[model samples]
Target: MRRHRYAKIVATVGPATNTPEMLKALFLAGVDTFRLNFSHGVQADHAKVHASIRALEKEVGRPIGILQDLQGPKIRVGTVRDGRLDLTSGERVRFVLEGSEGGKDAIPLHHPEIFAAVVPGQDLLIDDGRVRVRVVGVEAAVIEAEVITAGVISNRKGVNLPGTLLDLSPLTEKDRADLAFGLELGVDWVALSFVQKPSDVIEARGLIGDKAGIMTKVEKPQALDRIEDIIRLSDAVMVARGDLGVEIPHEDVPARQKELIRACRLAVKPVIVATQMLDSMVNAPAPTRAEASDVATAIYDGADAVMLSAESATGRYPVEAVSMMDRIIRSVEGHKLYHSIIAALEPGEEETPPHAVATATATLAEAIHATAIVAYTESGTTAARVARKRPAVPILALTPNVDTSRRLSLLWGAHSVRTDDVDSYEEMTAKACHHAQEEGFAKPNDIVVTAAGIPFHTTGNTNNIRLIQI
Candidate 1:
């Protein structure tokens, strides 16, 4: 089934939506990509989910992308004596380096980088800022902090050091193992969490090589300082606003998000706006009015895709969440102002072959009122270039490689179909027209625009465009 909207939907797969039948239902409800969160599942669990996804893909005859999210270096407090402790406001606590059973006086701090990086007056947010603490003193192997907000301090609660750049690599030992497993599974995308600099992206790229596309999760404030370089190095970027909201001022998130989307558009990389789009749907059958508006706003801001986390992974009503998100996207895309908003954000004149062809193809499509823009791509670059233009017409990308087709499914306004490699321009055009009609994008005598490389089956050679009628 074809999705009605241009922007894609990424759904996380977990226990609630891991079954083949549930996955099929989600795909039918308009989930273009499945994210396997490495933070929670083991290799066996992910393997099962991956197999089920492939099975559903074969049954539906559509390429569904799989993204493996690597859990980066996550610092946490060590174990407590009673598994939990209650700390009151203004209480002084000592975070010690030595591993010891935490008591009312002191707790174990495993990461040495925290002691080395954090200084007096820096805020330490725990459990997503539920308990805030200010560093009062720092010694060689100890950190003295006073609790600003009173809350229970549980065992292994997450630690967030705001405004402190830790001297630690994004990839931990666990992440390397998880990446190897995900690569062996042939996942289409690898999302590296907590990317702080361009070097982090380069490191991930080195490890991933050409096996899978690297998508950097921009949650750290430090990433914004060098976002241009990060976007240039990454194959894609995720606007991960969950922890990002914790680190930075909440009011600044919207502007930062817009900046990231614009940067990715200019770089011609697929960008995903993620986290809490439909959070209320995790338990309830419908989303809040504000949540609906939030999803629509992301679409209006020209996001390539909107993602669902717990709402689709462990939510009680996974299918309902997908359905609601689908409805919201469709309704927003149908509005007349949607076209105006997207057209306003189109990229300006760029002196690149792909950019020239992409812009011209979009203009010609709108001028001739073509039914669709058919792109024959091998690396998905041409499709991405056209998507960057944000054309009003639909994009049908035909690829011989299944991986390329699946990856393109996450792109905005691009519908990917796997087909054989054509040997000539006429054959390519004929195949495009045939698939366009078969895919319900056109009918007999309907005009369509075809774009491909003159030298058949070559990548990055989208030098020809033709107008043909089916």
Candidate 2:
């Protein structure tokens, strides 16, 4: 089905919406992509959900994107003497690297990487920073830290060390296993978490190859330090605000979100603004006013997609959440301020033939009041380039490869259609007009812009642009 909005919606699937009926309903409501979070479910369960999404895609006759989110690593505190222990402020706590039961002063934390990298004066935030401590002395096998924000520190509570770059791989054994399963299952995108540098993207690329798009989750301050390099290496980027907010100051998240969105758009890569867009909808039927404004702000900043995490994965009102986000995006995109705001941030194109032609195609289509811009792409690059321009009209992408079409579903303003390949210019024109009308994007007497390459089915050779009368 053709959506009325420009920015896409990515909804995570879990206990609440894993069934075929709910999946279809969510898709109908406005979910362009479905994320199978590997953190919570087994492979068997995810396989069933993946099969269900493909079935729905067939029934609806539209390309649906599937993103596999790998749970990177679980760094937490080891067990203490009891299940929990209370540490008072201004008291000393000794964290040992040995695996042994200890009291409040001698807690066992066996992560060698933490001890190898952590230094004095660095803060250790526990249980989402409710309990904090600062390192006073670093030893070979023990770390002496004084409590800063004293509270009950329990077993397996997550640890966050902000501003300290740990010398560790982003992927763990579990993530490697999950990646293998997801790639075999034919997922469209793979989101890498716990990324700390551009090398993380390169490492994932070595494993993922071209099987699926590698989307780096920008959640750490170190990732932001080298974000431009990471963005260039990654096929896509995700503004993961949950862990990011935990790592950085809360006030800085809005500006970081905007910066990442702008960088992704400039690079012509699809960016998804994820985590807690409509979190209150996890139990409620509707979202709060603040949540609605949060979603609208992302669309106004020109994000390719805004995602729903718990709101759809385990929420009581999954369909309502998707519908509300869809309405919010449409409302924002329909406003004059949104158009002005987004258009004003359009980055300068590179002085390359392909970039110039792509920018010109978008400009020409909008200037002529075309109904849509039909992009004939082989690698989906041409369509993605035009999408980066953020034109006013819709982008109808025609591709022979189903994978390309499915991946394009996550791009902004793109309605991807799988069609047969065209060889000649005349055949290209006929197919473009036919599919433009067939897809309900155009009708008789409507004008459409066709972008194709001279070598026919080549990639990144977008040197030709034509105006067609439908």
Candidate 3:
């Protein structure tokens, strides 16, 4: 089923929504993409989920994208003998390099990069900042710290150093293995987590090549420092606010989210605002009023998609959450305020051919009152370029590549459908008009602006634009 809404929904798959029937319901409800979180499940479990998604895609006749999220450099404390311990404020603690018992006084933290990179006065956040510590002394094999925020410390709790940039590889051995498995499963997108710099994207692009789209998770504070370069290197970006909120001040998240979304729009890259959009719905039947506003705000900011984490992964009301998010996005898009906000945003530079043509397409559609803007794309670049202009009319992207169509589902205002390849301008124009009408985007005698490369099946060769009447 096609959704009338411009923004898309990304749902995480877990035990709650892993069945084919449940996946189909989610897709029908408005989930354009499925995220396979590698942090929780094994390769075998994820393989099953991937299989169910493919089955549902065929059954539903929709291009559903599968995003494989790699858990990158997750630093955690070693196992504790007592299972958990409480630390009081100002209590001295030692983190050692060797694997040993984790007690109230001393714990094992074997990540060499953390030990080497962190210095005195750096703050350490453990268990998502439930407990905090300040490094007072540092040694090659150990670090001495005093607890700042006292709380229960559990075994293998995560560690976050907000004050220092660890000299660590973005990918771990586990991530490498997971990436290979996801590639084998034919995932459409791969989201690299904890990206620190542009080099991280370059490294992942080397591994992914053209097999899948590489999406960088902008989580770390350091990552924001080099966001421009990283955005240039990666195929897409996820405004992962969960870890980011932990790493930086909570009040700064809103502005940062807006900046990230705006930057992605100007760059003509698909961006998703993720983490806890409907978190309360994980347990409750309905979301908080605040959650509804949050989703709407993302749409107003021009984010291509808003994601759900535990709310869909293992939530009690996965389908309901998707439905609610869909309604919120549609409601916001129907408002004059949303349109005004989108119109006010600064677009990309129009000097380039793609940007100029895309801007012209949007202008022509509005000027001529065209029914829709149809783009024939092999790599989805043409569709993205048009989407970046934030046109008032709906966009129909026809592609022969299933992967391209699926990935386009996450782009704002682009309704992607799989179709046969068209070799000539005449064939492309005819197909565009036929699909626009068949897809209910237009009717007979309606006008549409079609854009594509003349040499069909060639990537990044969008050089033709035509106004066709069906």
User: What are the RMSD figures for all models against the true structure?
Assistant: 1.3, 1.1, 1.2
Rank candidates by TM-score, best first. Answer: 2, 3, 1
lDDT (Cα, tens digit) per residue for candidate 2, span 72-131: 876788887878999899999989898767887778887899999989999988888888
**Ranking of all predicted structures according to lDDT, beginning with the best and ending with the worst:** 2, 1, 3
- Provide the TM-score for each candidate, comma-separated: 0.97, 0.98, 0.98
Candidate 3 per-residue lDDT, tens place, 1-470, comes to 66898889999998899888888889888899999999998899999989998988888787889999999999999987688878899899999888678676569898998888988999999998899999999999989999999998889899998857888888999999999999989999999999998888888888889999999999999999989999999899999999999999999999999999989988889999999999999999999999999999999999999999999999999999999999999999999788789988765565888778878888899889998999988999999998898888999999999889989988999999999998777777789878898888999899999878777778776677799989
RMSD of candidate 3 to the truth, in angstroms, is 1.2
- Pairs of residues clashing in candidate 1: none
Greater-lDDT candidate between 2 and 3: 2
lDDT over C-alpha atoms for residue 289 of model 1: 94
**Candidate with the greatest lDDT versus the true structure:** 2
Q: Which segments of model 3 are wrong by more than 4 Å? A: none
Worst 10 residues of 3 by lDDT: 346-355
Model 3: lDDT equals 0.90
